[model samples]
Target: MGRPRVTVIDIAQAAGVSKSTVSLVLQGSPLVKGTTRAKVVEAMNELGYVYNRGAANLRQTGSKSGIVGVVVNDLTNGFFAELAVGVDIVVQSAGFVQFLSNTGESIDRQREVVASMREHGISGLLVSPARGTDPSDFAPLVEAGIPVVVVVRSLPGGKLSSVVADNPSGVAGAVRHLVSLGHRRIAFLGGFQDTAVFHERLSGYRSAVTAAGFGFDEALVVPSAPSRAGGADAVARALAVEERPTAAVCFNDAVAFGACDGLRSHRLEPGRDFAVVGFDDVIEARTAVPALTTVSVDPQAMGRRAGQLLLKQIAAGGVSSEAVMTSVRLVVRESCGAPRLAAQA
Candidate 1:
């Protein structure tokens, strides 16, 4: 027994069919007549054959051509995972293979992933850039003639087509909810101050607070990482102030979680001690120790729409600054404390 030689050719010969027919049958192609496919299968079982899927795929697909590249900040985040599902549906429907790259919020890493995708001959790209990334960072894909779409956030100067949530309106809705519950002293946490999306949200927060007959105190607003540490730090810092806000609105759920953790560290419960709210109602929001009151952005819909946009551009030989804005909703949960004491009285 030298190498246990067995091949598709041998199976085809034994089954009394051509090698092409055996290949078709093995690939599950409907092109093969049922009787012929049954005969090929019977011969395969009789010969103890082991099909090499990698080689078979290569032979059938005629090379590694149907690749679509998706670059996200992190895969561990449920938001990105949901987005991936949406991307997959469209890619699969179009008979394309998907390649996912997590950049871990590193601008340099994003560049590397793009370079690798270009080298691999990806047909198109969908990206959610790291914080503070420049539109020029995506220049390589454009120069290489690869169609690309930015999801969730747009690059500075509106250079790329994007599918993003209506941050201002979403924040306004959140603030109005807090106001209705009699929250006058409200604060904001997380989110980079300079980004377009954050700037819009901050404006909405300020506008809402003012319209609700409350002074917009800059002291209550905190800028921190959109991570747990950022949330915790913001809460601690806000609590240190002479006039601590009775409620806090976060950049996203991660920040809100951290804020809740920070509050607990100080022996204060998040919902009962002070109202807390977060954006981007991630999967964990509902399942957290006390469910998170957050703004829900449809990540899956954004992903699918982004894929569709990029594919459309690819098919039409590129497009101009087309914008698609999706809506957001406030999902109230355990956090973001009850109506004010005065209102209760």
Candidate 2:
């Protein structure tokens, strides 16, 4: 069996000190002598005694713990990572510790982490809900009066406050940019239809297509995993059809990269033989071969804003159900066959 967790009692015994003295040292009370404090510190280090600050705070005053929980769908993605950093910037400065968890888009996993965080006495939670997440999934936390700020994907008709990108406007701008470059048959590629993000982006493409005086061809919309492999698969399927599109807009940067890889496999060159556009201007987008053209939603800014909103609710002791929509801009670059001279906007 694994060793039991080291505790304050163990520290006190190791230092030859009383339990009350150990507690006083832990609390940084000046009344404790320097030599005794050093002895306790030495014992704590040797015993690997980890403090449960959050739990101790709750026990001390029965008030909110100075800890905030951040649960993301995919921490592996650079977008989410940067977003978490933004949250940390605000949370850390506010004297709150962060508890981060990656759900990998599993509803069960998300629920478990969120519940566990609550038990540990987190004052608030910031989450990027998994696909197909029901509004009811956060019911217990909501009932318990924890402020939750949903970022990225939002629960439609949910009573939760949300902070998300302007998905429709971002894609609409991308479609317009492609059209301006003479790509009449631009295809919307990659992303499962199971998400509200998918529908909003698709809605933009459809409106843009009809606005350009072309009938909305449902055939032009291809759905796949919101991943690089899925992007490549979507391209393969789109190419298999009788009518081929000269240009495509992808769900995200990962898919855009995969679409480029798929194009190369078929002896086609991205930015030369076929034009591709991606959403979410992740860090890798600029450095990728042929540089991905994408919608700049500023994930970090969105995250910072979400953190600020959540802290506001925590301070107010109220939930507003206020949804915030951040704006986006299209960054024209090489993947769309645009000149390499176009600097990132």
Candidate 3:
């Protein structure tokens, strides 16, 4: 007896439909009529059909080896970890494997990781750049027909597609909330004067402060690290000043945690003696000693949308520069208190 050959062709013949119809059904294209889809599925089951690379291509509409690369600045941060979950969900659903790469915010390391991905046949890249990274580093991939999507941060003057949270709006919202509390002496911590992300947040802070009729105090602003240790060190020094701020708005929750710790070490309760707020609403914010008041960015949603956008671009054969912004909002917690004046007003 000859070997039994079960192909999509056999399934199409049994279903009394064209091969393209069968392909459309398998690909879950909405264009396939409902009744025809049911009939094709029934035929596929009856013929004991087998799937092959062609059917796979019909489903994905891409030449990837069922794999894509997801790169981030720091994996240790919970924000990125949550974002990774969102990316994974979309990749798995599309029948593609997700290869996670952490650059630890190192530009050199990021380049190395990209090279490795290319060697392994990964043609798609999703990245959140490290500080001071050069967009030109990925120019090679861009020229080689690979798709690259930026998340969390946009490269200056680089014509790459990106998805990020509205840092300005989020920061402005936080600052405005504090101003409503009558805190005229609020301070910003954990940010330098440069970097797009930093500037976005800083600009929003300034706008809110100005709109509230307060002067921007460079004396109150402290440049520090975005991590807990960096937060601790900066806060300790700021607290030693003759005129300390009644409220401190941190760059992110990690820095907020450090600030809170520093306040405690100095016998000051964050929400009592002074108010503190953070950004990025990492999971730890909800469980901090005095729960952190923060702006929450839904990393998972951002990741899922980014992945879908990349796939859509691939399906369309190519795409021009597109930017997507995820929404952000404030989560009130124990860490931030209404300034005495706001309470009276």
Candidate 4:
């Protein structure tokens, strides 16, 4: 009742060539003459023949499935969105399709997505892990021999390759810059205490404060949600303290924006009465009122680098277990009061 499926043999017969010639054409082997390849392709088209890459990969030894899995904790954030775009650019150019998933900072969701990717026979994975992800979460993937390249957030003591921005150095630069501006009382705002990023940044903040001959005050550190509302709340709390901070280094651009809002609500100008600095110089940061001063991580570049790393692991058929900490820079803007100071000078 059903029509017969067109096989490579049918294409070969239609083109007056051997089955081997059709196979060669499918593989894009240069061994076959261009004219022969053209003939085979034409025959395939005329006969309605479709090449089954999955079936072919199964027959070949160590052939790639040409699929890479990319998972991020939060796709809603512009930073992560740009990072995913970067991964896509590199992975697409390498003749690979990416299965990208947003975990929304859920550990269970991350585990589910990774397992699904494995079931689909992905050659490699690029992950920006959700909060609270354990080393054991990746054990199944590792055992299955799938190469994984972690991006952005990293899992400590795990034998997995990772690409992350230099968090401590970036935070240090922010702190140093704020201190140089003659702000004696500076606050570290937003971000929960549990994450590695928070720890690294806090360490840098403390080190920079002490290095600059300022007393390390634990009261100056305000832990909150890393969201805009969280930033606002953190600033409100900071203001209630006996010796309110003059400037604040926020967790991210969203937090910085929230801090600015909080300042405005209190009839205080953000750049004038209270200086603010943020991390992840997102696009909005450049255009915001009294544009945000922040750390430039270049999310897209990081994503592309992550893609390159994943491809290498896929090609090698094993994880390199290397950790790459990409560099970050401080981008000065109006929000930090640097521009006004320069003008005055």
- TM-score for each prediction? 0.77, 0.81, 0.78, 0.81
By TM-score, the candidates rank as 2, 4, 3, 1
What is the lDDT for 235 in model 2?
92
Between prediction 2 and prediction 3, the one with superior lDDT is: 2
Name the lDDT of candidate 2: 0.87
For each candidate, C-alpha RMSD in Å? 12.6, 9.5, 14.1, 11.7
Report the error of model 3 at residue 222, Å. 1.1
lDDT of 1 by residue, 203-245 (tens): 8898888888887889988998778888999999999889888
lDDT by residue for model 2 (31-52), tens: 9999999999999989856555
Give the per-residue lDDT of model 3 (tens digit) for 57-124.
54466654666789998788788898889988998898878889999878889878877776566647
Cα RMSD for predicted model 3: 14.1
Task: Look at candidate 4 and tell me the lDDT of residue 8.
Answer: 81
Q: lDDT, candidate 4, residue 18?
A: 92
**Top candidate, metric TM-score:** 2
Q: What lDDT does each candidate get?
A: 0.81, 0.87, 0.81, 0.87
Candidates 3 and 4 compared: the better one by TM-score is 4
Best by lDDT: 2
Provide the lDDT at 242 for model 4. 95
